[model samples]
Target: MAAEPQTTDHRKRPRRRGDALIAAILHATVQELEERGYAALTMEGVAERARASKASLYRRWPTRAELVMDAVYSVIPDPGELPDTGELRGDLISVLTRTARLLDGPAGQALRGLMAEVLPSPERMGQVRAHAQGMGRQMMEEVTRRAVHRGEISPEALAPRRMEVGQALLRNHFLFHHEPISDEMVEEIVDEVLLPLFNTSPVNSAT
Candidate 1:
């Protein structure tokens, strides 16, 4: 006998495939950056690497800076994954350690070189600067929010600071390429330089 038709389970929305496309493009861009470095990294290169045409890439990204920014976004760890641990020291250390790891790799070298080359163009520099600010600020905001939620610091204290600690750490390497920045130094900077500044700040005073 023929079996009766079972009731269909419906209501599930079709999954968005755009993320996959973006992820693919991002991955391809990263590979190109690493293999070719900044000087050779191009839209045509990324398109060829990604198996898509130059037109497709242009539709999504009008400029090399924007494409590079998207690729950067794809690689950096999502803020949600960062642990709170309820202690500023631990949180800062964790993030720094991670940042160091990313910088120590090939992609880091490619990006650092790229940063130097793009300085000649005011327009390109502006685009790169804005992208960096958006990503860096967002990450710092996450850490600051965690600090307040855990009673680590006053909400006002952290917000006003604009999360310069991360910037300072990266600047150490960017500004002085030869100076050896150690993980030990990362801890020392966090403990010695930043911690004291926040502790005595008026914004952090008990509300």
Candidate 2:
């Protein structure tokens, strides 16, 4: 007697696709960053944690730095979303404070790891530069544009370096100093460094 072939128990959770899959992968990346950190994080590790295939991660992010950058960005506020506090100082403080806060999280962890790993390779360094420069610089540019429109500062203040100053200082402190950047430090950066740099007399300096 020929026995009927047993059916396989093929009931598995419906696969996550599109944004859902991306979100799962990103969440897994963040968890890996927090737990194993960037130094130990790998695409295989992220894929395993996400319950997705290694090919899935590789298809989206070709490299570890790319994956880590996207994961860090996923949890942080959009750089294009500027805080309108009605004044340059208020906006500056608000933005800087937000960055300082993020530094205490997965973003900072990724930065420390990337900085260590990407320095030797120019290609990776460029990727890191793009990631670092894009976030804070875009925010600063919008904030500065608003300030200029408000007549709070002159257009001459919008130099590449000027836009980079606040973030550079914050990152320096975060990397070299310690965690949980203080509100007082943020305020000092806004009041002392950023404001002065942006509002400097035209006669005194250029950008």
Candidate 3:
């Protein structure tokens, strides 16, 4: 007698949760971006690669741009509290170097793609700048705050432009020159620009 035909059970992929799920999605995003470039990236493709549903991605990140930005930012080290090197210049250099290194990898590629796509849309450009510059500013603030506490700089030294100078110079070099930021360039920014801005004594005015 012939045996009854066996049935194949089609099962849905197991649900991924919490950090594991996010990690898988992020990894898939980077892989997709690297392989297909930003223009070819899609929510459907990422979900397929991640073995997750499109609903899962949309729930976390409402748009493709948001998802890509989050993936890029994930690789960047949190500024946290940096070690106090006991000097302003050393602290600035250390923090700036870290930022430069982050921009040299996947974050850099994502940024280039984001800029090209978003430049034509003012709203999108604003979103991109806020996401990118916000992190840099936070790092700079941490470095500068420590300097103030150490008496290396005064409260008056905390000006908006002064706080922004280090990251701005580093970003300018990266965006325009499109080269890996060098130790020499980092030093130049700290020495030639930031140090003077932070350390300079205010000019006295005669009434």
Candidate 4:
């Protein structure tokens, strides 16, 4: 009899645990978002790419939307670590520009896909909404707090809506418009909108 050939078995690979496994899965998720995009991404696809078990992903994220959201969030620049440009306009522009870049990448794809997914519970949808919006606000808060400390704006300038407007405008244009966001638009947002909104003098100025 002719010698039989043996094939490599992927299943026999050493199992990954804890952070290493989670990191691999998230990386695979982003790769899928970049390649297959969100609509076509499946748990099986991510598991196969990550060389992880589907059950591992399911154990952490019960739904595809949840998995995608977590994966997208993991890749976002941390708000607490954003650089301070020492002035409100510079800081605003830098933060918003970084966000614009994020929206132009896998994070953007994940958002578009998640928007179309029909979750079984309204609560699940709410969680998705919260996670999506919360990070933007947190980033704004980081910049705003720095501005306030530098006396560039009144503490009152840090209203919820004001904090949200820069990100909101960028997201609105990104979601609806066909073109990549322009430098002029980012500047206009900082100069024409955010700067004026945040230009309030101190509350005790008159005293």
The regions of model 1 sitting more than 4 angstroms off are 1-17, 178-181, 202-207
List model 4 lDDT by residue over 14-41, tens digit each: 8789999999999999999999998999
Better of 2 and 3 by TM-score: 2
Root-mean-square deviation of every model: 8.9, 4.7, 4.5, 3.4
TM-score, predicted candidate 2 vs. hidden true structure: 0.86
lDDT-superior candidate, 1 or 4: 4
Off by over 4 Å in 4: 1-8, 119-121, 201-207
- Clash pairs, model 1 backbone: none
Error of 1 at 207 (Å): 20
lDDT of each: 0.70, 0.87, 0.83, 0.86
In model 2, which runs have C-alpha deviations exceeding 4 angstroms?
1-11, 201-203
- List the candidates ranked by TM-score, beginning with the highest: 4, 2, 3, 1
Model 3, span 67-162: residue lDDT tens: 999898886667776766888889889989888887787677778888888899999899999888888888888888888898888777776656
TM-score, predicted candidate 3 vs. hidden true structure: 0.83
The segments of candidate 3 whose C-alpha lies over 4 angstroms from its true place after superposition are: 1-11, 18-20, 34-36, 201-207
Better model by TM-score, 1 or 4?
A: 4
lDDT of 1 by residue, 76-161 (tens): 88877888767887887777676666666544655566578688999887876676566566666777678778887776566544
The superposed Cα distance between candidate 3 and the true structure at residue 113, in angstroms, equals 0.5
Q: lDDT score, residue 97, model 1?
A: 71
